[model samples]
Target: MFKKLSIGRDGADAQARGAGAEQRALDYLRRQGLRLVARNYRVARGPSARGGEVDLILWARDGTLVFVEVRARERDAHGGAAASVTRAKQRKVIFAATCFLRALAEIPPCRFDVVAIDGDRVEWLQGAFDVPAEH
Candidate 1:
């Protein structure tokens, strides 16, 4: 999966690039038969605060709920995008997912996926990472 790592210049421009990458990731997953559940899913940790942002959420072919993180970098400069998902970031995502699950009647099987794009190359890591229990 070769992706040219197309990202915007900086600031809001960079955010737009991130959004674009997310859309591309969503489209790619749709081609693979994943049904979209949500995009840019966010959960707040407080009454007036911000929390983690899940780039994309989808139902997998086997019906497993998927929480996706789309990372687009200019290059694999610092371990690329997949490697950028640190423990702290994982905690945030897990936190958001927990919030999402609370609204469900019955929670389905879930897994975390990452779509790492670096310099025109795309790597889709299924069940890429896990949620730390301590989080």
Candidate 2:
């Protein structure tokens, strides 16, 4: 005798799709010559603030520290996926990035970037947003 098991197909499919998108984005960045430093850096919550995370941290050949946010959408149904990184999201990313750099003795020149994956197309936006002031 044999038994068959079934799982949540939709949820599993979504996760797999997301993972593929992230990998594709990473490869795209590497091909562009941005050295990969770290991925998915998380910042612990402060006393009065909720913590957040950065998707990717990269180092350029020119010694520039880059904080990257990767957003993936099945399709550009709502002004494209890049447009999804709203002001609130950017602030959270900036906050997390500041926390990350504070732990380092020497802070390098830094920038923000957005990697948007729309289907098979990948768009890399450098200097996507200015570094937010310490709050």
Candidate 3:
């Protein structure tokens, strides 16, 4: 689940903040033993596509493909970082994952993960949400 962060409407700033958070999450995950495969993976399925971007894609030590959604909040005024991952966001990640796998030789086991950062603290949620269907 996402923490429903309160982000500004300013797209560029939001992206900068998102990139920073993703870097933090990536570093932390690397320390935890996940191998970085892709960062900021995006694919467009066109006009009616549910496609979007995936913050970080990691390969678990045991071969699981990890799709991570990175969230961060400067303050907990809204609901913290985990509160931001809405169903729509999850769907977008899923769609992007599908596009990524289409180029793979074989699809492996995978899970959706959330890395929530509040203030200076970071919390990693494994299997935060089930991998959504491509359709």
Strongest candidate by TM-score: 1
Against the true structure, whose lDDT is highest?
3
Cα error, candidate 2, residue 135 (Å): 4.8
Residue 10's lDDT within candidate 2 is 82
Candidate 2 vs candidate 3: the lDDT winner is: 3
Give the per-residue lDDT of model 1 (tens digit) for 1-135.
897885656598888989888988888899999999898889866763648878898999998999998988988998998899887788778878888989999999999999999878888899888876664
Q: What is the TM-score ranking, best to worst? A: 1, 3, 2
TM-score of each: 0.87, 0.85, 0.86
Q: For each candidate in the order shown, give its overall lDDT on alpha carbons.
A: 0.87, 0.87, 0.90
**Least accurate stretch of 10 residues (summed lDDT) in model 3?**
126-135
Q: Where in model 1 is the C-alpha error above 4 Å?
A: 1-9, 47-50
- What residue runs in model 2 are displaced by over 4 Å at the alpha carbon? 1-13, 133-135
Per-residue error for 68 in candidate 2, Å, reads 0.5
Q: Can you write out model 3's per-residue Cα lDDT over 3-120, one digit (the tens) per residue?
A: 9887657888888988899999999999999999999999877888556889999999999999999999999767899988998898888888888999999999988999999989
- Candidate 3, which segments miss by more than 4 Å at Cα? 1-10, 132-134
The model with the greater TM-score, 1 or 2, is 1
